[model samples]
Target chain A: MTIVSYIFLIIGAMFFLLGGLGVLRMPDTFNRIQAGTKATTLGAFSIVIGVIFGSVENHLDWIPKLIIIIVFIAISSPIGSSTIAKATYRSKNIPDNLVQDDFKKRGENQ
Target chain B: MKYLITFITLLVVYLFLAGFVIEEVILGSFVSAVLTILLANRLNFKVDWHFPLKLIKFIFVYIPVFIWKLILANIDVARRVLSFKIPLNPGIVKVKTNLKGDLGKLTLANSITLTPGTLSIDVEDDCIYVHTIDVKKSSKDQNQKEISGPFEKILGGIFE
Candidate 1:
């Protein structure tokens, strides 16, 4: 169980690193948001699951707290990303090289 | 009905956290009742006889698929980020959804954001504008199918 938890922790750390790197490497705001949000959400989830496994051997009481944390992250992370994406779009900070942009065609931003 | 459901859910969660001690149960009931009375009207989703069935479907069917896709999404991100020459053909494309309910649309948007290579930017009328890391399919219908096919189908069953 400890070994499994350690493996998950390592995986989670690696994903977090990837998320940071992606945010730095991506060309524009939207791409950075996508990379940062997706990678970090999964990274945190993996770490929480790791903690749950690591502690379940000691006591069952910790399960609810950990589960609540997981649920909170799952609910909040996507919403946060969506809200940021909308804000970025509204601000007209979008990239010119977008291969397709239906939002522009719809005249929603202006 | 909504108030009752909210109160019950709150009480259950409190009891789960508090381990059903007598004092905690009484306190939880009081707090849940107060909260339900105050907040029930803000709870948008309707609860009916079908709620339990929908909940079961959400847990048994929807959760597994979401988790699987979440794993795939992380793997996709890992691949994109780790490559020295990152492959990206990014775009914002519109996809129409058949779901009418707000909750259904919200779920679809959130799921799309979390899933592989797609992030939902805006939802307008029956169409969602999605930011795709790779613009594999240019047609709107194909984009709609590729992005939200399974989610829309399952969520339609649950939320609609």
Candidate 2:
């Protein structure tokens, strides 16, 4: 169990690192946001869940709180990202090399 | 009926969040009941209420699979980020959805936003505009296979 928890934590950390890297490497705001949100959300989730497993041997009481956090993340994180994306669009923050602006096509400027 | 469901849901959330103490549960239920009665008309559920057994199935069955995909997505993004000069052809593509209810559309939109390489930008009618990290990867067929195909099946069952 300890080994498994260690693996989860390590992988979670790796994902978080990769997400930060992706943010730095991506060319534009939209791409950066995509990379940053998707990777970090999952990274945070994995890390928390990993910690739950790690705590199971001695700190079993913490498990429900961790699950609650995970559920909160699962519900809230995507909505948060989508709100950011919508804001970026409304602020004319579309990426320069973006192949198409379907919002423009759809005339959904709010 | 809708108000009752809303009250029950709020109570459950309250119990989960408040650590399931008897006092907390009772207080939360009273608070939830009042809130639900006050807000019930705003929910706009015109149809007669039915037991949401399929929705329970969706929560239990579909959510675990969605989480698995999310893990895969992060790994894929990490791989792409770590790779050298893998040309990212980012673009907005429209995907068709068959989900009937407002809740279904909202769930599908949120699902796509969190999944690999796709961010759901807007939904106009039955079409959803999604920004992809690699447009080449999210061709129409792939969109059906990857994005909507997974949840659409169970969501259809639940929301229908």
Candidate 3:
């Protein structure tokens, strides 16, 4: 593997590990979702890019597929995280020390 | 015209991702574009021909700020989780919004949910139902004001 590929692999691994740590260490469901989405998206993209770089055969094919993967991840991760966070919030699992909420006002306005 | 553009964009996106050859891709794109246009027209969704340039720009600007907030919240949450006491004072709060459009409302709601420690549960006409992780620091009502302040400004800049 080339130096760049190795670098990408290392970066990907670090991001994946950070995501795991965030999931384990975050105090609340919302925080965990934030960490999981951001870190995992970066991690997965990095790994895919690394693979594209390291591959000797059909490099073009891999690159396009990687691009597709990145695009899908970017679009979908936030939606999934938002859904989970909403569910958790409705379920009343949030931490007790929160300072402000804008959603409730939205409810009142309706 | 707006529906046509949206349809074309969607079709192109679909074909590009699907990785079809040029001819097949064009055929698929045309079919999907026509379908999208028909559906959108039938649904009575008004297509705003004049683009919200300011709103698009604001979204880009707000992204970095949102990321910074996420990182800070992550650290705070991590610390709390590691502590033996696990300091938490969860509560639900309502926040008022000034965004005038559906897109603006959605942007604000999604942004709030993306932030660590806050979840946007529901969105009413001009209000939002947010569940917060820490409620001991302030009253639920006060929390609503503080929580909505930045988002209101950001979305206001974008939508209004």
Best by DockQ: 1
Model 1, residue A98: distance off in Å is 0.5
Write the candidate numbers in order of decreasing lDDT: 1, 2, 3
Using lDDT as the measure, which candidate wins? 1
**Candidate numbers, best DockQ first, in rank order:** 1, 2, 3
RMSD per prediction, one decimal?
2.2, 3.1, 4.9
Better of 2 and 3 by TM-score: 2
Clashes of each: 0, 0, 28
Interface RMSD for all numbered candidates: 1.3, 1.6, 4.4
Q: lDDT tens string, model 1, B78-111?
A: 8888888889888988888999988788888989
Which interface RMSD does candidate 2 score?
1.6
Give a tens-digit lDDT track for model 2, residues B40-134.
88887564454477657787987887888888788788788878985678887778999878888988998888788889888778888888877
Q: Where in model 3 is the C-alpha error above 4 Å? A: A1-110, B19-21, B33-40, B52-59, B81-85, B139-142
Instruction: Locate the minimum summed-lDDT window of 10 residues in model 1 chain B.
Output: B136-145
lDDT of 3 at B52: 67
Model 1 stretches astray by more than 4 angstroms: A108-110, B16-19, B38-46
